[model samples]
Each structure stands twice: as C-alpha cells, then as structure tokens.
Target: METRRVIFFLFDQVHLMDLAGAVTVFYESGCCGQPYELRYVSPYPQAGVSCGLSFTNLEPLEAVTITSSDILMLAGMDLSKWNHADDMKWIPWVQAAAATGATVCSVCTAAFALAVAGLLDGRPCTTHWGYTAALQEHFPKAQVLENRLFVQSDNIFTSAGISTGIDLALYLVEQDHGPAFAYKVAKDMVIYIRRDGAATQQSVHLQHRQHINHQVHQVQDYIAHHLPEKITIDDLAALVFSSSRNLTRLFKTVTGITIGQYIKELRQEKALQLLKEGHKLSWVAQSSGISSQGELRLLAKQAGRGRLA
Candidate 1:
C-alpha cells in the first residue's frame, strides 16, 4: 500500500490545535491500513506559535515537494498582523502544489493564505466566522459561506474556526477510506463524526447528548445501533429495567424529545444515509425501520418542512 503524505504548513503565531487536530486524525487514520507520512514545513527553519510555544525540526517550505497523492494543510494564525510581503514567497509553492493535483486545505484564517495564492478564486470557501466578511472583502472572487463547518470546492477545502479543523480532517478521512472507518476513529477520539459541510452549527447526535443520565444514554445507544429493529418504549424500558412511562419522561427531560420522536428522527437520518449511498427506497425504508417508502417520504417531507421539531 502506498502511503499518502500530509504536509502541514506552519507559520509564526499559528494556532497549535488547528495544526495538531488534523495531524492527529491522519496519524490515527493509519489504523485503516493506509499509512500516512506526516511532515511539517515552514517558511522559516523554526516557527514560533501562539501561547508562547515554538516548533523545531521544521523543513523549509521551499525545500518540500508536493504531488497529486499528497495533501497540503495550512494552519490558521493571527491574520490581522500577517506580513503579506514576507509570506508572499510561499504563494507560488501553494499554487504549484495545487497545480499538481494535491489536495490543498486551510483551517480558519489560513484561508487568507490560500486566497493570496489565488487558489480560492471562484471557489466556495469559508473561514472563521469573525473573518468571513474580511475574507470576502479581500478575495472578491471567492464565495465565502457563513456558519459552515467547512467548505469543499473540488480538491480545495476550507474550514471554519479553530476546532472545526478536526471535523474537516475527519471528513478527509471519510473521503479517503469510508464513513465506517471515520466513525471508528471518531469513536476512539470520543467525538461525534459530524456531518458534511452543509450541516448546521451542531449535529443532531451531538446536540441532544449533553446529559448525565446513564439510563437515557443506554437507551440512546441501543436505538442508534438498532435502527432497523422495531423498538418500542417497552423494549427500551426493559433495557434499563424501568417502566415505560418513567423512561418516556426521563428521555424527554434529558434529550428534549420523546422516545418515539427520537426513534423517528434516527430512522429518518438512517434512511437519508442509505439513500445517499445509492440504496433503493424500499431497502432504505426497511433498513431504517420505517414501515414503507410512503412513510419515509412523509418523514422526509416533515424534515424538509422543519416540522420534525
């Protein structure tokens, strides 16, 4: 198996987590049987980062070579104080990498660097919410989306603020391997495998899970794994040795949704996933525990109408 190279472009005052988060995803992605070679390149021999930290053993950006099979990531930094003249030298390198078909991406304000390289022109991109207007003002050709976790325009990807870098990295992993493999990595990391860039600020799975009820969580886990099973309040109550009525009350109190509603939402989500993967409507309906295609359509309509809430 050929190893893919992930080159991280480091610069002065770079956000450490933005750099480390994506690196960690690729590092752990080796479990999928494809190893990745991680390299950190910078315009300088050494680069000082935020929070009084510095990185050594960095390769010079001019010395690195990127290929089509490789990925180039630019870490976010203090864009307001960025010295455009000093960093303009790296623009050609970024353009060269992109021209070679390398997947180029940026986290947060790093989109500014990519824009300066002329790679974001006419592309759907996003940066930190606070900098979205500024990015649009500077790069008039780029379509800057607001509130998106990340945006992918062909091989060029740009992510929202700091922590969304991890989300973007996991997404890249999903693109490389598959959703199942990405889910495994996310489980190991104890983070939700967020949906694609079109999703809102938070995922449905992450939003309703911020509670401390063990029994409720157990029920949720069971529902998630058994989406195709005909689950009832009695069955769920039996799992946690509680009464149906009490479980219903606790589930609503904890998750802000009734058990039936949660099950319906889960089934609809699963149906959408199956459909996205090219499954037949009947098969998706069966697999997602919906009674029939008509019912799935009803659920889809409700979702589209925002009536599921």
Candidate 2:
C-alpha cells in the first residue's frame, strides 16, 4: 500500500463544511490505520472562507506535486463571487493532474469548476440541485445528471452539495479501503444516516444504521467486517455486553428491523456490489456470507435482480 496523497486544492471563499467533511473522512481513515497523506494547497497565500474566516500559512499549489496516486479535491464556492481569471489559472494544473492519472473530485458547484477545467467534459457529473441545469448549459460537453448525491466517472468524482461531500468522501474511503472500514468511519463521525430523497450507491452498510444507539453502530460494524462468518444474535449481544434478548429488542427498536433481516439486506448488497464488479459466483457467495452459489442465485432471484444470471 503506497501512501496516497489526498490534496484539497483550496481557493478564496471556499465553503468550510464542504472542505471539512471530506477532510475529516481521510483524517479519520488515517487514524483507523489507512495511511493517507492529507495536504492542503492553494494558489492564494491566505485562503479566505465562509463568514469572514481565513486560513493562513498554507502551502502554494506550485509546491505540491500531483501524482497518479493523489486524490485531488475542489470544494465549492459561489461562482459569481469567484475570480474567473484566477479560477481559469487552475485549469492547466488540474488538467495536468488528470493527465497524470490522479483522481480528481469536486463538491457542490465545484463541479462547475471541474467543468471549467474541462475535466468533466463528456463525463457524467452533478452539482447542487440549483446548478445542475446551469452545469449542463455551461458545460454542454459534460453530461450533467440531476438528483444524484454524487457521480463518479472513472477516476473523476463530483458531489451534489455541501454535506454530500461527506457522502462522497465516505464513498471514496470505501473504494480505498472496504465497506467495513467506511462503515466504521461513518459511525465514528456519527453520520450513519444516508441523505433522504437522494439516490446514491451509498454503502449498503449505511442502511439499517439510521439509529444513533452506540451499541447498534458497533454491532453493525462487526456485522460488516464479519459478514462472511456465521453471525449470531448471541455473538453480537456478547460483543456489546448485553443479553441476547435485550440486545435483539434494542437492535430492532433502534434499526426498525430484526438482526436477521438486517444481515440479509447487507449480504444482498455485498453480493450485488460483487456481481457488479464481475466476481465469480462462488467467490461472491463466500465473501457475502451466502451458503453457496445456489443461495446467491436464490437471494438475487428474491430481489428480482435477474437471478444472478
């Protein structure tokens, strides 16, 4: 595992939370033992932010080198207030970053920025609800998708709005690590609930985890990592230091479903993701906790997803 750099390329008037959310994701992942060298660079010496806040003593974009393993991020700001000439200066740098195989990402109206950089050209990207139309109109070459929380096009990623940056970050963490580790990051950040009314391939583990119960989140984390194992209510209860009946009751009360049902949904989602990635049926079954390919086919059939064909 190489030490990948997660670079936040900042500018004046950058939204704080949009930057903070994604920053926290990688930072927490590092704390969780996935080493990501987080770096912040800006063309501006002093980066002005929302509500008169500012960051000083920051490294310049010229100082940091973008490599293929780097994750380059652009947090959004009001396009109208943006210095178009200064913004255009970033185009060449981002183009170079992409040409070198870096993973470029934009949050909120930053998709417009990426579009301005020509990174979103011919790529399916999204932004805040209000800007999707403008994104399409302005970057006709870029395919703008509406109502998506975030859209990933090959190595490029774009997120819908402010907090969706967090979702997008979680998604990236899952891509870098695994769903189990992303689940832990989300739970630790207390963002277990998926955004309502938006369609995302948000981790299946994020579902059935809408509750804030500490023990429930721990159990869900355990279930995520141990999905391929034989999970029992008694085992989960013991892990949380509670009686099986009490833990089961509390789990259902918090998550609105029994543990068995929750496990089934998680296994289904894992199987589905594995299938999408073109894993063989036997491997999918073993990794997703299914008894066999026969059970995997049955699970896919019950979900009306073409019987794993």
Candidate 3:
C-alpha cells in the first residue's frame, strides 16, 4: 500500500484526546508504519496546540496542506465559545481539502467547525452532546444527530465527545484497511467495545433514572438553580403541565435518573468541586443541600473518595 498522510488540525482550546486518540489508534495499528504518515497541524505557529487548556510544543497547520493528506481531521472544541472570525479563516482551506477527495472528519465539537466550511450542510452529522442543541441552532440545514456516537455521510464524518474519537478512528481504519486489520488494532489498544453511532450517550445514567418527559429537564434546571429548595416529584410535575408519574418517566428519559437521584448526583458532583477548593466536608454538605457531614462522607465515598479518611 502507498503511504497516505493523516493531518490533524490543532488549535487553541482544541480537545487533546480527539487528536491523540485518533492518531494513537492509527499509529498503533501499523497503518502509519507501512503506508501512513501522521502529522499535527495548527493555524497559529506561536499560539501552539492545547486540548481545551494548556500546551507544550506543536507545529502550525500552515506548514502542511490538507491537499496532500489522505485524511484531514478537525479536532473538537467548545462550540459555545467559538468565534466565527477565528474559525471562518479556515473555511476556504477546508473546502479546498474536501475538493481534493480526501476524507474530512470532525470529532465532537469539531463538527461545528466542519459546518462552518459549508461541507456538513444538508449532511448527517453529530457533535458532543453538550453542544448538540447549539449545533442545531447554528446549522439548521444540517441534520445534527443527538444520540449517535458518530455519523458518516459520504466522505465527511463527525463523532461525539472525547473517547468517541477512537471509535471514529477505528471506523476510518476499517475503511482504509479492512475489518480484520481494524479489529487487530482495536485489540492491541485493549478496546473491547467499538460502539456504533446508534449507541446511546446516556449510558452513565443508572436504571433508576430513566425518565423521558420534557418536564424532567425543566425540573432539573429548576432544581439546579434552586439547590437550597426542598423539591419533590409532585412539585416538579406541577410546573410542567403533567402528572407526577408522567414527569418521572420523562425525567428518567432525559436525565437517565429519577428526580431524587439526579439531584443527589448533581449535589455530590458539586460537593467534590467545593471540597477540592478547600471547603470543609460540613460546608460542602450545607452548600450542596445535603443534611449532614455523615451524608456528605457517604456521597464522597460513592464519588470514589472513600479513601479520603
């Protein structure tokens, strides 16, 4: 097989795993060993590459051209804070790259970047769940999938958050090589699950939390804003024009947890943040709406801080 170039477009606040996971999977598969070349490219030569945070040393995208690459991957980022001025500059280059017949792809929030280039318009695409609603708002013409891990429409591909980049890479491997080769690479990487796009993103939700009512999200938001309030299912249902039972079902679907469990988890997740910021366990409990330090300790234990003593 002839050597093919895989260029990664890195930028300030770029998601690190989106680039690392894809590059690592392909490199470890021996795809890069025989006929593949992997390179990191960024728009700013001095700005450097950071995975939504800080960085060390990275090359500039200007140093390379996507025209020469077999695959051009636009790593994901925070779409809410994305500026069109900074992003629009790359549209012409991306459009040109796509015209070259090279596969252009995005992982998570990177899908928004691809959409900016007009390449993803009228195509099936996806991004990180946190930004799915925003993606739809921006690209009304594009069919932005919500539940899938990734979507491949023609030569353009888009994936969900963080680890899904690996899944996208494996799909690419299967396309460029074969299923057997892709499987071998997955095995070497110790990846036991290669989730298809249809896999639900709500896997983290416990069974007790699987409600599907619209009011659930509304109630959750309300609870989040009023953490000090003592909320109940009935109180939440009253706000949504639905009965308690119906609200519970909807809550479970939207949040993947019952109202009580979602509240507890949200409180606990917030407690940990407070604790790390030097808040005492008792203070964390009070601020997080829990009753006692003992309950806080238990929540901490459930959060995997059991060793905190």
Best by lDDT: 2
Q: Count the backbone clashes (under 3 Å) in each candidate.
A: 0, 0, 14
lDDT by residue (tens digit), candidate 2, 1-309: 688899998878898988999999999988888868999988889989866899998888878889998999999886777888786567788889989999999989889888888888899889999989988998899998888888888889899888999988887888788777887787678776464345545455666767778998889888988989999999999999999999999999988988999898898888877776767677888898987666677656645566343
**lDDT, candidate 1, 264-287, per-residue tens:** 887877776666566666687768
All candidates: TM-score: 0.79, 0.84, 0.59
Off by over 4 Å in 1: 28-35, 180-184, 187-197, 200-225, 233-254, 272-281, 292-294, 297-309
Candidate 3, 151-195: lDDT as tens digits: 888888899878889988877777777655665566567664355
Off by over 4 Å in 3: 31-35, 47-59, 197-309
Better of 1 and 2 by TM-score: 2
Using TM-score as the measure, name the better of candidate 1 and candidate 3. Answer: 1
Model 3 lDDT-worst window of ten:
201-210
For candidate 1, give the lDDT: 0.82
Give Cα distance to truth, residue 245, candidate 3, Å.
48
Give the least accurate 10-residue stretch of model 1, judged by summed lDDT. 300-309
**Order by lDDT, highest first:** 2, 1, 3
Clashes of 3: 14
- The lDDT values for all models are 0.82, 0.84, 0.71
